[model samples]
Target: MESVALNPATLSGPVWVVAPHPDDEALGCGALLAALVAQGTEVWALLLTDGGFSHPGSRTYPRVRLAALRLEEWRRGLQVLGISPERSAALGLPDGALAAVPPEQVTAAVRRAFQLAPPALVLLPWQRDPHPDHRAAWEPVRAAWNTPVLGYSVWLTGRGAAADWPVAAEAQVLTFDVTPHRRTKAAAIAAHRSQLGLIQDDPSGFTLSAEMVDRALTGPELYFRPYGQSVD
Candidate 1:
């Protein structure tokens, strides 16, 4: 696992960020997105799921309302990262059931995205992430496009040791020094109010645990190159 700083200049083409859920993009690549946008790189975030099931047991907020709230939260959060609503989209796929979406549908969506602008890099959740939805998000995209990818981690960081990391033996780890954009990243993350203990009444409501947020904000953001070419 080799570490290196992100050189924004190297990212000269359009970039696509595939988030399994709304907040994953911000938590995993908030600083990266801010840095890329500063370099004038064309960037887009495609949220694969509606994030409606974060608090699945809640009777007060039905799935439809919850999905709508999450979408709005995502828009506001992206704006903080310097991406306009026009540059981002939600596939409207059901939350927590990405594996059930027709294989062809996922492929077609990705293919269509390429038509708008072929990405020089596609950022996705690491394949070995503990969250089922995170891992499921990768399969279709993996099968759909041969485009270069750098899988960012959200759930894997909890392992807390290099030896325990769930990655291919040959995978190259790239670390981006996001110190300059740390505050921006935090602000972007905070924009997702619904995910950060904002809903207090429901015991089942989702909350990004403070420990995870601390780890994310502590240092350089890491990305995994599972195979083939390196983005560096």
Candidate 2:
């Protein structure tokens, strides 16, 4: 039962999640986030991208309007999972353009998220995810490694996406098994209707490309402390 943090404090106060995109939240830690909210955690989700590249027909739609639509998708999705709009932020960064962003801008965003969140446990994508968004999303919250940084995998499955970050940092990896609550998790994911058109068009196309999605989450959750405090 060491899979999830059983302490009520496990979900207490101001929790922040840095997602590569809107669906990452639901796919990565939907159950945990829901469980935390069910226990009363003030959760904030900082979505890094607008998911602009997802629609093959996006070229026909105004980028700004498309961005706005995706933001709404996230809004509805979070609501289904119990997260308020005030608790969520959509940066709307250009999709597939993260690696091209200026370093200053990336650092500034990360610095701001922490300043605003002051999170007890900052959640982010497991560094090894295949999606570039997942990799680039690291820009903003990476420095918070000094605090408790929990890496959630939406790509790698069997046991969650494995963390590729060096073990020289003070980071923790926790896995939440949502099999019992898969319906809630899946419903939360379905809230992103605009973004899931491929699956919407064909539900059978739901592939776990993120790598973290295939790793079955276990009970009590799994936590890995990366740096082990030696770095500090």
Candidate 3:
């Protein structure tokens, strides 16, 4: 995959963002959402999972409780990005198990979101994001819709890329100058406090270090168009 440059500000109209978990949207495209909303672009978010599995072994926070909490956190996070609750859909799929869900169900959810707000472009998790849930969500949508897709990366660059990444010679990397919306992006990410070390009981629970948050804040929000498709 070769890399080409793109500007992210031009995205307009009804936009749908598909996130694997609660904070994936904040981590992946908070700035872009903020930029879009600021420009009066109507945007919708589709959260595929509850993100409850982060604290897998905690007796203090059961799966049900965690799921609810994560959903609330996700709502708050999207609010920070300026999306109203009515515009977002929490599909309630099991955390960490999207890959196992029925393909029809997943496509139904995608279709439902489209009915809610037909997307000019759909923002998806990068196909090879190194997260099973992210990959799971991407596959069904890729197969179901012919809409233009802009794949955002949360774990791919963090894990280091292999030769297959960026999608061969046709990849175009879209970059957005998020300086105006950086503060909101950080707040949206921080809204997921549980994922950022607030869960003290579960030693094994996932926690993003301050360093990681800082790193995400420093760069422009980016996405990859595998086939060099226009996001407009």
Best by TM-score: 3
For residues 1-232, could you state the per-residue lDDT of candidate 1 as single tens digits? 5566667677656888888899898889888899999988999888888899888777767789889999999989999999999888678888989888887898788777666667778999887777778877777887667778888888787854455364556577878876889999999889888888766667967789999888788857888776668664
- Candidates sorted by lDDT, best first: 3, 1, 2
Off by over 4 Å in 2: 1-12, 58-62, 144-146, 158-173, 198-225, 229-232
Candidate 3 segments whose C-alpha is farther than 4 A from its true place: 1-5
Q: Which structure among the candidates has the greatest lDDT?
A: 3
Q: Would you list the clashing residue pairs of candidate 3?
A: 1-168, 2-168
Note each model's CA RMSD in angstroms. 2.0, 4.8, 1.7
Instruction: State model 1's lDDT.
Output: 0.82
lDDT of each: 0.82, 0.63, 0.83
**Candidate 1, position 14, lDDT:** 83
Assess the local accuracy of residue 221 in candidate 1 as a C-alpha lDDT between 0 and 100.
80
**lDDT (10s digit) by residue, model 3, range 17-124:** 988899988988898888888888999998888888999988888888989999999999999999989999988898888989997889987787778877888999
- The C-alpha stretches of model 1 lying farther than 4 A from their native spots are 159-168
* Per-prediction TM-score: 0.92, 0.75, 0.93
